[model samples]
Target: MTYLPLVNGERTYLATWMDLYSRKVVGWQVGKTMEDELVILPLRRALQWRQPVTGLIIHSDRGGQYVSAELKELL
Candidate 1:
Protein backbone atom coordinates (compact mmCIF):
# COMPACT_ATOMS: atom_id res chain seq x y z
CA MET A 1 0.00 0.00 0.00
CA THR A 2 1.09 3.60 -0.54
CA TYR A 3 2.13 5.62 2.45
CA LEU A 4 4.01 8.73 3.62
CA PRO A 5 7.69 8.52 3.19
CA LEU A 6 9.61 8.99 6.46
CA VAL A 7 12.34 11.08 4.87
CA ASN A 8 10.46 12.81 2.08
CA GLY A 9 7.08 12.92 3.85
CA GLU A 10 5.34 12.55 0.52
CA ARG A 11 1.85 11.16 0.59
CA THR A 12 1.95 8.11 -1.65
CA TYR A 13 -0.68 5.65 -2.73
CA LEU A 14 -0.42 2.03 -3.84
CA ALA A 15 -3.14 0.12 -5.61
CA THR A 16 -3.27 -3.64 -6.08
CA TRP A 17 -5.78 -6.12 -7.44
CA MET A 18 -5.63 -9.80 -6.46
CA ASP A 19 -7.41 -13.00 -7.38
CA LEU A 20 -9.19 -14.70 -4.51
CA TYR A 21 -9.38 -18.17 -6.06
CA SER A 22 -5.67 -18.63 -6.61
CA ARG A 23 -4.44 -16.15 -4.01
CA LYS A 24 -2.31 -14.44 -6.62
CA VAL A 25 -1.72 -10.80 -7.43
CA VAL A 26 -3.37 -9.85 -10.65
CA GLY A 27 -2.00 -6.32 -11.05
CA TRP A 28 -0.93 -3.13 -9.29
CA GLN A 29 -0.36 0.63 -9.73
CA VAL A 30 1.26 3.44 -7.74
CA GLY A 31 0.71 7.15 -7.57
CA LYS A 32 0.21 10.16 -5.29
CA THR A 33 -3.50 10.65 -5.57
CA MET A 34 -6.40 9.02 -3.66
CA GLU A 35 -9.30 9.63 -5.96
CA ASP A 36 -11.75 6.77 -6.42
CA GLU A 37 -9.99 5.78 -9.60
CA LEU A 38 -6.80 5.17 -7.67
CA VAL A 39 -7.71 1.51 -7.57
CA ILE A 40 -9.24 1.28 -10.99
CA LEU A 41 -6.06 1.16 -13.04
CA PRO A 42 -4.91 -1.97 -11.29
CA LEU A 43 -8.35 -3.53 -11.45
CA ARG A 44 -8.58 -2.99 -15.17
CA ARG A 45 -5.20 -4.56 -15.71
CA ALA A 46 -6.23 -7.56 -13.64
CA LEU A 47 -9.45 -7.91 -15.54
CA GLN A 48 -7.55 -8.11 -18.81
CA TRP A 49 -5.63 -11.12 -17.52
CA ARG A 50 -8.57 -13.06 -16.06
CA GLN A 51 -12.12 -13.79 -16.94
CA PRO A 52 -15.02 -11.51 -16.17
CA VAL A 53 -14.98 -10.21 -12.60
CA THR A 54 -18.58 -11.29 -12.10
CA GLY A 55 -17.94 -12.99 -8.75
CA LEU A 56 -14.94 -10.95 -7.72
CA ILE A 57 -14.81 -9.76 -4.15
CA ILE A 58 -12.59 -6.72 -3.75
CA HIS A 59 -11.37 -6.26 -0.18
CA SER A 60 -8.92 -3.81 1.39
CA ASP A 61 -8.28 -1.42 4.25
CA ARG A 62 -10.93 1.21 4.87
CA GLY A 63 -8.69 4.04 3.83
CA GLY A 64 -10.38 6.92 2.09
CA GLN A 65 -8.33 5.87 -0.89
CA TYR A 66 -10.28 2.64 -1.12
CA VAL A 67 -13.67 4.30 -0.61
CA SER A 68 -14.41 7.14 -2.96
CA ALA A 69 -17.41 8.38 -4.82
CA GLU A 70 -15.72 7.79 -8.16
CA LEU A 71 -14.55 4.29 -7.16
CA LYS A 72 -17.96 3.38 -5.73
CA GLU A 73 -19.49 4.51 -8.99
CA LEU A 74 -16.79 3.13 -11.25
CA LEU A 75 -16.42 -0.28 -9.60
Candidate 2:
Protein backbone atom coordinates (compact mmCIF):
# COMPACT_ATOMS: atom_id res chain seq x y z
CA MET A 1 0.00 0.00 0.00
CA THR A 2 1.03 3.59 -0.66
CA TYR A 3 -0.27 7.05 0.11
CA LEU A 4 -0.32 9.61 -2.67
CA PRO A 5 -0.96 13.31 -2.53
CA LEU A 6 -3.61 14.51 -4.90
CA VAL A 7 -3.63 17.80 -6.74
CA ASN A 8 -5.97 19.16 -4.06
CA GLY A 9 -3.29 18.46 -1.44
CA GLU A 10 -5.33 15.71 0.15
CA ARG A 11 -3.89 12.23 0.43
CA THR A 12 -5.39 9.04 -0.94
CA TYR A 13 -4.43 5.45 -0.36
CA LEU A 14 -3.64 2.90 -3.04
CA ALA A 15 -3.70 -0.81 -2.33
CA THR A 16 -2.51 -3.44 -4.75
CA TRP A 17 -2.32 -7.21 -5.04
CA MET A 18 0.46 -8.46 -7.25
CA ASP A 19 0.98 -11.90 -8.67
CA LEU A 20 4.48 -12.84 -7.70
CA TYR A 21 4.77 -15.45 -10.41
CA SER A 22 3.73 -13.07 -13.15
CA ARG A 23 5.18 -9.97 -11.54
CA LYS A 24 2.06 -8.09 -12.39
CA VAL A 25 -0.50 -6.20 -10.41
CA VAL A 26 -3.66 -8.25 -10.58
CA GLY A 27 -5.85 -6.10 -8.42
CA TRP A 28 -5.87 -2.62 -6.95
CA GLN A 29 -8.01 -0.07 -5.21
CA VAL A 30 -7.79 3.61 -4.39
CA GLY A 31 -9.66 5.34 -1.62
CA LYS A 32 -9.61 8.41 0.59
CA THR A 33 -9.27 6.33 3.74
CA MET A 34 -6.82 3.59 4.59
CA GLU A 35 -9.41 1.36 6.16
CA ASP A 36 -9.61 -2.42 6.03
CA GLU A 37 -11.85 -2.14 3.01
CA LEU A 38 -9.01 -0.44 1.16
CA VAL A 39 -6.96 -3.61 1.27
CA ILE A 40 -9.83 -6.04 1.33
CA LEU A 41 -11.41 -4.76 -1.86
CA PRO A 42 -8.34 -5.40 -3.97
CA LEU A 43 -7.73 -8.75 -2.33
CA ARG A 44 -11.29 -9.82 -2.94
CA ARG A 45 -11.02 -8.70 -6.52
CA ALA A 46 -7.83 -10.70 -6.97
CA LEU A 47 -9.40 -13.79 -5.49
CA GLN A 48 -12.45 -13.45 -7.68
CA TRP A 49 -10.33 -12.85 -10.77
CA ARG A 50 -7.63 -15.42 -10.21
CA GLN A 51 -9.46 -18.17 -8.36
CA PRO A 52 -6.13 -19.75 -7.57
CA VAL A 53 -5.96 -23.24 -6.25
CA THR A 54 -5.62 -24.07 -2.60
CA GLY A 55 -2.59 -23.27 -0.47
CA LEU A 56 -2.35 -19.70 -1.60
CA ILE A 57 -0.35 -17.38 0.61
CA ILE A 58 -0.75 -13.64 1.03
CA HIS A 59 1.88 -11.39 2.55
CA SER A 60 1.50 -7.82 3.73
CA ASP A 61 2.96 -5.33 6.15
CA ARG A 62 1.68 -5.09 9.73
CA GLY A 63 -0.60 -2.21 9.02
CA GLY A 64 -3.88 -1.91 10.84
CA GLN A 65 -5.89 -2.74 7.76
CA TYR A 66 -3.79 -5.82 7.11
CA VAL A 67 -4.16 -7.01 10.69
CA SER A 68 -7.81 -6.14 11.13
CA ALA A 69 -10.20 -8.82 12.34
CA GLU A 70 -12.46 -8.29 9.40
CA LEU A 71 -9.70 -8.91 6.89
CA LYS A 72 -8.37 -11.85 8.84
CA GLU A 73 -11.79 -13.46 8.82
CA LEU A 74 -12.12 -12.86 5.12
CA LEU A 75 -8.78 -14.49 4.48
Segments in model 2 whose C-alpha atoms lie over 4 Å from true places: none
lDDT of 2 by residue, 1-75 (tens): 999999999999899999999999989999998888999999899999999999999898888899999889978
TM-score of every model versus the real structure: 0.64, 0.93
lDDT of 2 at 41: 90
**Weakest 10 consecutive residues of candidate 1 by summed lDDT:** 1-10
lDDT of 2: 0.92
Count the clashes in each prediction: 1, 0
lDDT of 1 by residue, 18-50 (tens): 777788989888777766576877877787788
Clashing pairs in 2: none
